[model samples]
Target: MSRKRKETEVFSLSFLDCICCGFGAVLLLFVLTASRKADQMDDLQSKIMAVIGDMEYEISLKDKEIERKKATLAVETRLAKDSGARLDETKKRRTELEDMLKLLLQQLAAIEGELGKLIDEKENMPTQEEKVPIPIPNPDRRQYLTGFDILGNQVLFLVEASGGMTADTLVDAAEWADKPEKERREAPKWKRVKKALKWMIANLKEGSNYKIIFFNKELVPLEVGFGRDWFDPMDPDLTVEVLNAIDDITPEGGANLEKAFAIVNELPIEPDRLVLICDGLPTLSDSYAGGGNQVMYDDRVAMLRAAQNALKLNLPVNTIMYPLMPDPGSAVHYWRLANSSDGSMISPSEGWPDI
Candidate 1:
């Protein structure tokens, strides 16, 4: 029995040793796998660090680019500001030019008046056998002045008081009003305007009633007076005052043409003379796109608003545009106004004559 027991014990011990050897082999294989895995993880970590470093460098480059753009933007902004200042200066000069023009207009009016008086006297004189009647120069030979001789008709001068007026027309009016009478007559303004005014004022006979009005977006009196003496066509003071007051004229803050038409409609006067002197078209009135340009409601709306208003007034409108621009309607509006009112013009059927 002892010998059998000893043999079984030896077998069991051999079995245990075999299992220990297998366990050792498995542990060795696990160590090899772990070492390979650790090597792969180290490589991946190196690759990730390289990529991260590259990303940081790329980010730094982008930051430098952003700084360059900022510097360029600053330079551009400064240049634009300088350019804007220059533009403002140019606009100021333009206004000065406009003032000079108005002075010229007033001077022309004075000259025309003197010429008209001389011409009338010359025409009335009897032709003698020896004496020849000097032919009077006709400033407006295209159409003879008419219906102006009818007295008691109120003269409502619808002067344009748009922003454009501030530039030239009105400033000259100030200079003309304050200037000497002789200078007013001798200047090119009166030299051109004298003849026209004289012919128009001729209608103001002994006891005629009249009133002079200046308007843009509102109605203002240059000089308000009535009666025959009031219509004295020989009012040098009046001429000067009108020319000066005209300098104060300005365009509408925003064109509400309805206001202008309403003013005329509510005047409660019959047989009136409405003169409209403007450069551009109507803007800011009630119409498509809000009367003028939505982006910029610059000039008056050149559309048919003026024409429609003229139709509503049922009266002739004398539109004198100063150096009208942008073609077609810019110049042609005058003709439309004249035709609508059953009136005719002499020269500058499109725009105004510089002289």
Candidate 2:
């Protein structure tokens, strides 16, 4: 009983106060630490957000730059493709132009060759000496024949009536040979030839005996009765009759100079002077009867020799040559013949005779 009275109060007031104070201090410290930690967490979160935003912005800029680069590359590629296509077109065009240039050069060379041939032919032409004019009754009327001398009393005119007389060139003659007879008669070359013949007849010595023989494949006189006879140049109606007869004739055959010379040789009176009016060398001869249309140069030369031999009389031969295509040898041959025969050769201009 005495021990229980001594230890009655086990938990005192002071001890309780000390425990509460300790609990209160612990709660205050906990609140202060939690507030500080919350503030620090908020600051750290803001900094992280700022860093993420900067990184995202940097990534967006990089994407934009890459897009720009891609666009630029696309444009460059298109330009490169266009440039390549243009280069290809230019190469093709250049090749075409080169081909055209080559063709033009070839044509130019051909033309130059032809021109050179012409120049050579012209340079090799024969030269003639000037002669004194023969006195005539009416010199004013026959002024065109001032330099031309009719030396012989008995003159024979051998006119060519071949188809080549209708045109200035063989090509034209061949083209016009199939035309109507009226057209051939109206040809400019034929008309000029007739005028030349008339001029020649008008300029013959007065009272001189003359014969006009037109020959092609066959010999033809002004009239059948005049075949072997000479015509009186003093006849007033003779020129008109001859002109009328010539007007009625149409050139249609190849020339046969050998036959013409043979006919002249058979004349009743031997001619002292022979006037040959021809366009080219003979294309027809007795030896060339079975020959084709094309006459070689050698064959034509042979025919010319034959024709020359046909004339038995040693008479002067005067040649009046007209233009003929591809007959470059004709001029030289005729010139030599005229020179050898002591006669003159004339290649009249288009404006000759002035009629």
Candidate 3:
């Protein structure tokens, strides 16, 4: 009944409970360690994935760079090919030019040999017709000008095919202007001018090229057909064609010397020398002046303009002045033109054939 004190026992429930609690704490510690290890592994895996993504991005940039380099290489190769083609073309052209030069040299040698033979034949036994060696007014090895001493490889004839060419006086010029084409064609002065032209053509060298331009109010070429500007007098058929063409032409318009010289300015290739066979100063400039004691002031002004234009050609202007009776001033102006341009003035005696 005392039950005052519970006796201390060696094995008690409290002690057992303490042992069990210690065991539970050990199990909890083991689980926490396993969880911590798993968490560390996950973090390492995330870092590795990020590194792989960066490496993939670098590889993509490298591929793009390689593509760009390939494109640049392709362009360079194309340019190189184009340059090679141009070089090949240049070489071919050079070869062709060399061949042409060789051919030209051979031809020149042959021509020289023929010329020597002609000289020998001419010296040894002159023919009856060759006895009076055509008096070349200004004999030169390079050219055969109609009236002047100047020589040239190429020659142009600027003939005044105007109504004034048919007569010696303005009254007659007006009268002839009213005449029919058939009658005007047979004028005495016109015939003489034509004869002189024939003589010049006959005396030209066999291979010489010439062009005849007739200017009145406008310019008229000897041959208007395509590819037929210069004439070869050596060809008998061509000579007849030119002669007939001249015969067909009739003097009817007022003389326009300005237009005549302007034709020279417009030539595709300038001649070495020019022979202007004009009667007087310009009567018709860009416009016409009625025949009534022709104004000399305007004529001189127009002639000055023509002379200045002619000077631009930088070649000798061998003037063959026709006697336009009352105008000695014309002769003076022509002389000044010749002197300024380093040319000669030849006034044929009386008529055309006299020269």
**Best model number under lDDT:** 2
Scored by TM-score, the top model is 2
Query: Pairing residues by index, what is the TM-score of model 2?
Result: 0.56
Clashes (candidate 2)? 0
Which residue runs does candidate 2 get wrong by more than 4 Å?
Answer: 1-147, 224-229, 288-293
**Weakest 10 consecutive residues, lDDT, candidate 3?**
141-150
Ranking by lDDT: 2, 3, 1
TM-score to native of every candidate shown? 0.40, 0.56, 0.55
The lDDT per prediction is 0.51, 0.79, 0.74
* Candidate 1 lDDT, 82-176, residue by residue in tens: 99998896676566446545656776797799899999998998996776866757533223254222233455544444343322354554555
Give the alpha carbon lDDT tens digit for every residue of 230-277 in model 3.
Answer: 887666556656776888888777667767776687788778878788
lDDT of 2 at 331: 89
User: Measured by TM-score, how close is model 3 to the native structure?
Assistant: 0.55
lDDT of 3: 0.74
Best-first order by TM-score: 2, 3, 1
Q: How far in Å is the alpha carbon of 259 misplaced in model 1?
A: 2.9
Cα error, residue 154 of model 1, in Å, equals: 2.3
- The per-prediction CA RMSD against the true structure, in angstroms, equals 21.9, 25.6, 15.7
Which of the two candidates, 2 or 3, achieves a greater lDDT against the reference?
A: 2
Tell me the spans in candidate 3 whose CA falls farther than 4 Å from its real position: 1-147, 224-227, 287-294
lDDT of 2 at 218: 91
